[model samples]
Target: MQPTDVSVSGIGTYHFVYKHDPQTGESGFSHLITPLGTYRTFSLFTSLGVERLTLVPWALEAGSQNAAVFTFDWETRVPPSGFFQGYPLARFTWPSGRRVNRLWAKRLVVYDNIQINWDKEDLLDSTSVELHDSVNEFNIEEKRQFGAGTLVTHVRGDLTLAGTKRPKPKRSGLLTYTYEYEYDLSFLVSGIRSCLYEPSTASPLWCHRAHIAFNSWSGYSISPLGANHFQDGLSSSLVLSQTGVQLNRRFDNSGRLLTFALQDSKRQEAIINVTFVYSVDSLLPSDMNLETIEDVPLRTHYRRGPGGRIEGIEYETVGSSRRRHVQVSYNEESRISDLRHYISDSQFAKAGSSESKHITTKFLYERGLLSGFGSWKYTFDEDGCLIERKLRDSGSIEDLFEYDAKGLLRWAERRVIPSTTSEGQQKTKLEEPFCNGLENACYPQEMGQVKDYAIQYLYDAEDRLVVLRNTLEIDDSIQFFYAHPQHRNRLTSFFHHGKGKAYFLTYEQQTGHLFTIEEVDLSAAADSNPERKVYIIITDTEGSPIALYSDDKVN
Candidate 1:
């Protein structure tokens, strides 16, 4: 009997055909399936993830720290034409954490909102090289019909803190918002609407989402983690014409994003338009521009070295433009040995003109190991662990970091530089040099003592950070205590005391997760300034809180 077509669910299922949009998705890459166009695959859907299915994403991108990646096996062959096909399967890169190069290979992505395909197979075989080296490839010039698939997203705040500045204990304070959505054939708001998100809305906030491009498709947010992983600076917005909100997206033959623009009810020009540029062999964008219809376009250009590593980037934008030129260098061992950043105005090109007011930051490394950044230098103990770090950016050691023998951090101090005054920023003339290798001393009059401005941390035998002490000003002592106040091997209590205000948290745990967290405000003397106790209650097995209540109100 011939193997018939059957739908499968979950991971690693058998006896079903894994096919790309069997007959749909955009034309170019989506339609091309296996190398032979008859191969089967054991495929699974993924987000920005690593190659190993059993492993979880170790770290997440908060902004543009790392690029977006989907279907990680793209470095070799093309994915079988299954649910999401057309993306270059062989363009996948397992990047190093530092973004040695900000190239198109890092954040290549294809959304199902565009063309999609699936692969089909009869069974799972351990001997199939097609499963390991299979990469999703693309074709050109295909028209596509899209659908607004199911999308779920929730974004919350970072609720749990370590020593001080305890977050609100209400479950409401922990969630920015939870979103559930669906759309018809075209991706539009099927039920609920999308909204704006304020940073301070939650403490230990959490965001979660599973789909893309809903009408309310405001921001690319929400993950199981309280982490921000979208492309840097992705925002939450509505597309309102004089009639209502509108969302639009366009893609080219290889499924690379051409533009993501929003139109509104007012019929004003598109509020936001993001365009991408790429090399033919790569699925990621080598250059990108994100801007409003009326604003000067902010652009990002990636530079690559002979090995395809990102050597530098030219970023033109506001706020972050000052630190635009990021250059990276490697050691003979091929590890990142140095990083340099030149801060200048957006108009300053990479010309070798002698008239550039570039604020240069140079990184320092010991051999191939990172030692410090810019004017910061360091000393290490015998064990190769970092010991002391001194920042001499302004001729004086503006900051110092010290660690214990076990590599635990012990002390950190930062000197506050006074602004230029009538004395012109406390100018000092030194006629005599310091003995041997001693550094010059320049302390502001505001600093009463040489060793006063610092913070200290203490850890337990188990290597858990347990205590923090602050001495920001002369004779002002602020301390916080952390202990396993409820369950063993768990620290649920954090008492913060400084200034005249204090915050205390009592974490409630069930099944090793936060169940309810209560917070109280206190006086400097620990007199316990009585504030209403805020409560966070979890109602699900995943420890997702459904309600956050405090003082007879649900927030």
Candidate 2:
């Protein structure tokens, strides 16, 4: 048996293991239990393979075992391939005997003759009625194509082919648009392929041929995902002689990425190369090796237990004296209990160097929930919302969080308690905010604090923060406003009453916070151009702000 995927739920983490039958050459799983045997369940398979795993907790009465089982029902019959096809998940049955039926478009035409499985439903089921009902059936209009295989081009579906029901016009509702595909073919001179022969023994010298590749997507009107700036192909070396660069890619038998290399052909050296190694038995990533232009090799090795859970990781720089090792210890419930980090200059030290710095983090759990870590104690409400977090060593209440019935954070309080002196006098009070109780509190307000600070939040109907009131002496209240219906929940501008200033923000669809315009003294902005400052934000691929650029400075 080999471990496949690990599922982590609100209760516990469960590992799914698959047993292979040598005689039948088939993969299947019968039953699975959590590490501590707290939950038992099995896999749910449909024509589309395993959909989800059910959770079955032990019941006091033996006859109720089957009643505790959770299940999912899927339509096994394969639907037609064209147009808006494939029905959404049928229903979900919970352990408490509750069932939810879902219906919406779950597939879309992502490319010519290619449709991808994706959910198009919003939280409130605000999708257009025509779009929602068009997913279950197919039409002959969708099956018509211009060509076959790589040259195929699909016809756009007309509004007449849409569902019969028309949705009521709403200013805030989403507008569904149909897709159109246009293909344009163009060829580029990629590289020059040459054949060489030994000069001493060959009568003829060598011949070279120019390699040209053609690309078509309606004349670049519709490129693939990510704009198709880079080349993607099978496991092979793609040499772009025009740029003197070589892109080398390798894949395993199962089509998993194994290695990728980018080289400078003129220098005859690799600019960057990465290799991925996976465990033979479980097919899990075991190691990663990277080589840079500086020729410094960095390697990371993963150590796993019998159940394929990562127990430790070692990072090393080849030929360098620097090394770091991280060891993970799990409790009987298979939850990470401790994490120890050891850094040393000696690479081959088996027992690790005693002189090296060692840092360890310890975790404690109560009733399957993390209760404390290090010197910090945490308390949660019945809904699992963190209510209070206190530092045991310092005897200080770090944060007392309060949540409303909707599970939204309403307020948070931090208290600082001064220690007693030898003469029974109170120690110096820490520089912290002092907040008084407000209206509509979720968690009980904590008492006994030399100094305290609190912040209360107010949300709009759409759950967008509209106001923030803090106990701070300055900037006590900040009100946020959203004016752009297209951007939805994004903030358009915010006013700082104490500072008498306002900030207008613009966002890049993916990167976020493209520019911030700060206005000072809103009262004097009627005729005067209030002092304004603009700051540009830089972000990474994942839309996380990495740096702020302003006045020739990056922060």
Residue 290 shift from truth in candidate 2, angstroms: 17
In order of appearance, the predictions have TM-scores of: 0.34, 0.42
**What is candidate 1's lDDT per residue for 1-555, written digit by digit as tens?**
434332232111223332446464411111112211222223344445322111122112223333322224432233444434454443232222111111123322222111212121211111111111012121111111223321222211122223233344311111122233444455433332222122355322212122323223223321211111122223223222222434454556665556655444455776555667777776656777766545566888877654456777777774453435666775443445565544454334555432233334455544223566655676643333455655454434355676543346767776645434333334432122211211212111222333436877654323445445664532233323222212225543444433332333332111344533435444322233455243434222233443343332334
Model 1 accuracy (lDDT, Cα): 0.38
Could you say which candidate leads in lDDT?
2
lDDT tens string, model 2, 36-101?
A: 654454654545622554545444233444435566655434343343255334556655444544
lDDT at position 377, candidate 2: 89
Off by over 4 Å in 2: 1-336, 339-355, 421-451, 472-474, 510-527
Stretches off by above 4 angstroms in model 1 are 1-258, 262-267, 306-308, 316-327, 335-362, 393-395, 402-411, 416-555
